[model samples]
Target: MRLAYVHILPLEYYPPATNAIRIFASMDDVDAAVWTSANRKSLPEFNCDGVRIHRLPFVNPGTSAFLRFYQCLKWHWDCAIALRKFKPDAILYIEPHSAIAAWIYYRLLGGKARLFIHHHEYYAPHDYDRPGMKLVKLGQKAEQSELFPRAEWISQTNESRSGFLAKDNPEIAAEKFQIWPNYPPLSWNRKSTQPAINGPVRLLYLGSASFHDTYIRELVEWVARFPDKATLTISGFNVDPAVWEWLEKENFPNVQTFPQGWQYDELPERLHNYDVGLILYRGNTLNFVYNAPNKLFEYWAAGLEVWYPQEMKQITHLQEATTQAPLRRLDFNELPTEGPFPRPAALREFRSDYSCENAIAPLLRAFDL
Candidate 1:
């Protein structure tokens, strides 16, 4: 079987995405290709395990939101041309931009391949909920055009999100939607639950710092208050300069910032250096409440106890999954003060059901692989 996989989002960082690596690995026995893009500032080509990658051409001279959108549209057209040339039997695309782009291409320019989509975020009817606004109306129309009953296969990051989508759009069959949580890769499956030393408890906060999760700012504030008790290390790309500037100016002895993040392969080892993994989001929006985060499992895989918001609907499964990796709710008043920390054996057991291999099993079966 010939297969085509397309992802319009930037894949500039490492460890390579779980889906990307899985697709490429599977390519060895079948005729397959992957189409993706990178920031213009980075190298234009990538090769993984003998699988060929086609990087879409997208040149954005400025960082403005409008320019980025325009560039992505151009990338979409470039992908469409490549899709026609490759003409595989089936195509799998990632959330938001890639899926929309592929659907547009298929609708405007004919294609016979069956199309599948994965939703990392539960994109509910935000604009449609408030239809009077001009931009909201446009947003609603665009979303409807791309994601409806037509998708051959649908996967979501968590059960709550999938259930929400199925309930919202009853026309789509319940069987069509599969729960594909943000499971970690095999490399992160290391389990070593040595207690976080009695000194300062090391904490990690990775990914975007500016977005929701006002609790992160609160964490920083808490660290500022008790500089000797715990140290927070912030890493990842696109962090707000102001946030970093404030941290630097304060020069809090306990807080450390590494704006340049470690490579993806380095995550497992890197995570072991810290005592706690933090994935906190303000559950103001339904998406936030229902979303499944990648960092949640990444921390557990590396055997670090997790601190997440109690309000998130997905917390139930995470709490139920492990005993060795103590799941702590984000507490403003204090950090984990007492431990002989739980050994990582239970978290390692939780890893069994939540790896890329298990997450993509249904997809492989549906594709008849």
Candidate 2:
């Protein structure tokens, strides 16, 4: 069966698009291709893990909603043209904007391919109050504008997201939304030997540096307070200027900085060098409260125990699901002064249960290929 995977973001920049391509490539009975936009300034064609990726022109999001909606319409036209040529049996649309574009292609333009949508986030109606959220809500509204009852839905978390959609739109059946958690491929197993826990435990904080409630600087300050207990390494794209300035001015003895972010494929091998992974989101919104972030699984795949906020519902749920025990829960206001810190012991079982292959099994089953 031929499957067309569609997403609005640049394929190289979006982890979810790459993850979907990798998952689809692993299937023996399916032939998968990706359709996405290249960077606005550049349109370069490259093969990713044996899948042929087609790139179209995309306008970057602007401050004005009119411009953003116009861009979305242009993207819909591009996707419709691509659909006519590729002629896949089914289309898997990633994120709300891409799914909305696919909906337009099928419903308005009389396309024949069955539509499926993957919801990577759950945004409440009131989530538009924050920065960058207004545009996100606009895209989400596009999906909700029509029920699309026949369209299959997938979520990156279990009940947190699926439950919200079902509650919001009672017309949609519960079975329409499948719980496909954000899991990495099975090959990212930990090494036989890890960084020793005898000395100061090596820790990492990776991903986006900009968030309203990130405690990165606070973590650095705490590490400085007890330099002999733990050390931290920080890196990610678009590291907030404030974070960089603070890191430079403070120059904590136990904190190391990497200005450049690591590529997605480079994380598995690189993560084993650290003893712990830190997730310091302050749980500012319901979306954050329900997040099943990629970093959580990436850290586990690399054999690093998590140092997460106990307040996060996603973390709490994952703790119960994976090991039935709490990880090193942080209070945010305080740091431990002890010698040895906690690490996870159940990665093998976690890997077996939530590998990307296993996570996407329900998606494949839905297609009946």
Candidate 3:
């Protein structure tokens, strides 16, 4: 049996478990080829476990949102052509973008392969529960209607998505929507818990593109007051030079900014050393809400307690101890001052389910491998 995997989302080798379903599937003898988009800036290919990969061409010259969308569309076409050349018996697609496009292409082209999709995000609007967020939800639901039923079957990471669709759209079989959470690569390992930084905690701001620069500004405001006690680190690729220079120029006593420019497979090692893993995302867009962030598990794999407002869907496995919301304005005025942050015991155990043992089963069963 041969499978053709296609996606344009980011890819990396370390954390071993990052995008692990694709990595592990590629490792199996039945695994055929993986066709995915390469970095927008450079194309470097390493043997990702055992899968043969084809990187889509780098086509972005501007950072406009429309241009980025065009690049993703262009890369999918590139990936589709690549898949046709490989001629696998089946196609396994990743969520958000993969399912809808593949369905349109497969129907139009009439390929011999069957198609399947897996979704890890439980996408909701940033203001989902508010009256103002109505139009936002409408847009998302419309997008879902266009895409969700197109799949022969789908695997959702959280219960809400699977359950909502089964009720809202009965045309799709209930069984087609199963709970499919991310599995860390079987190679992922637990790291020693990183003790919080002394004096003040070191906050890590992780992002993929320039979209998250706003969060860094908020961090600057918070850190400006506690420069003696706190420090912030921003790591990601494709950031503007002006943003970098602005942060440096401030020369705050407690802030240092570094561009963690695209290091795959090396993430686990790099993350293990950080004091706290920061997951600061602000968006009402489809990509942000439906996200069962890979880094959530990656941070756990490295055993760092995360600092976010609340847990995300599909990955609230803060089985051990977790901090409370609003680190920006921590209001512990009435509480006792002398206790530990009150997290659960060891994080190593909570991370186990995210490892391949739990994550890979659904993928295997999906293909009957």
Q: Please tell me which predicted candidate would have the highest lDDT against the true structure.
A: 2
Give candidate 3 misplaced runs (Cα > 4 Å).
Answer: 9-18, 25-28, 43-46, 56-85, 99-101, 120-152, 163-168, 193-199, 208-214, 238-245, 283-292, 310-352
| Candidate 1 Cα misplacement greater than 4 A, ranges | 13-19, 40-46, 59-70, 127-147, 193-196, 320-325, 331-353
Q: Candidate 1's residue-wise lDDT over 27-50, tens digit each?
A: 545677778876543423345665
> In terms of TM-score, which candidate is strongest?
2
Per-residue lDDT of candidate 3, residues 1-369 (tens digit): 687776545454222224554545555468667665555445344445567777666446567666765665667666666667677777877655454346445644556576676655554434346653343354345335644555556766656566754665677767778776654554556655555345665566665434342345654556567655556677766566766777778777666666646465666777766555666554344345344556666666666666543323323333223443122212222222332243333443344336656666676677776
On lDDT, who's better, 1 or 2?
Answer: 2
User: What is the per-residue lDDT of model 2 for residues 1-369, given as tens digits with 9 covering 90 to 100?
Assistant: 889888777776666567768777877877888877776423233356767777766666553677866676687777877786788888888776576567666767777877777777776767645675554565566666652475765554667877886777676767777787777777775442653466787889997665467777667777777777778999876578788888899888888888767777888878878878888887887877777687787777766777877668878887777664325668776666553364544432333234777777788888886
lDDT of 3 at 17: 25
Return model 2's CA RMSD, one decimal. Answer: 3.2
Show how many residue pairs clash in every candidate, following the order shown.
Answer: 2, 0, 10
Order of models, best TM-score first: 2, 1, 3
